[model samples]
Target: MVGMEADGKMGVHLDVSTPGYAGRLEVVEGPTGRRVRSASEKARIAAESLMPGAQVSAIARKHGATRWQIYDWRLRLRLGELVLPESQEPLFAPLLVEEAPLPRVTPKPPKSAPAKVEIAINGMVIRTTVEVEQLAQVIRAVRASR
Candidate 1:
């Protein structure tokens, strides 16, 4: 007979008087299985699993979950389906801004003296550092004067 006992335990009573049946079968009630984790909890566990040198198996065992569950949660996090609470999220240190050092200014070498050339035209000598084109014009003017 399958029925609830007076002690609040559900049990099965077998007919021990029957041939070849000598033991009574009792069914004890236990806790309901399959815990439901919240999204924040999943996110927290997933984040912990992602930490440096963190072992997924250890984290999952600690949280009464499987490594696959943590992996799924991580996938959900990457897909934006899981959102970690602000307090549980990683924090970054504020950046410090400072003026960069001025670049070194090296002194330039002194400029070399311009080249000088002498030209003797119509027995009159000319020496200057003027450009070739300007010197040609001056020579032309001198020839035209004669």
Candidate 2:
């Protein structure tokens, strides 16, 4: 036996050709009716269960499962591969759309006229009002700072 005490639940058998009873761990169909958890999911769940203070192995023992199985489920959960139990009817009255406050829309300021800055480069149309002397001073300051 690969597990502990035998639980009489009808589990999906991983070994199709082999017939036997499983105890703590059961090979069961997943939400998609697939035979097993995807390999990545298995690894992910294993990693989560291994996280500090996560009672993964104990949970497995209590649920008649393996730590690996819980870990696989955790991985699947992360990837959103597992399907939640569906209910067509809402258990409670859903809040009406109108009851919720509409999002506040911030009005954007109107665009202003573009500012002009002039450059000394040939063929360049500079719109800046800085005098030539000021430009020279700024350039010297910039170079000095650098």
User: CA lDDT of each candidate?
Assistant: 0.77, 0.56
Model 1 vs. true fold: TM: 0.46
Q: TM-score for every candidate vs. truth? A: 0.46, 0.25
lDDT of 1 at 45: 87
CA error at residue 45 for candidate 1, angstroms: 0.3
Which one wins on lDDT? 1
Q: How accurate locally is residue 57 in candidate 2, as Cα lDDT from 0 to 100?
A: 72
Per-residue alpha-carbon lDDT of model 1 for 1-146, expressed as tens digits? 33322333455444345546546788878866789889988988888888778899999999999999999999998898998898754733467999999999986545556547777877888787855446567778777877
lDDT tens digits, residue span 79-143, model 2 = 76753335433223456665778899997555555444454545554455554436667567545
Candidate whose TM-score is highest: 1
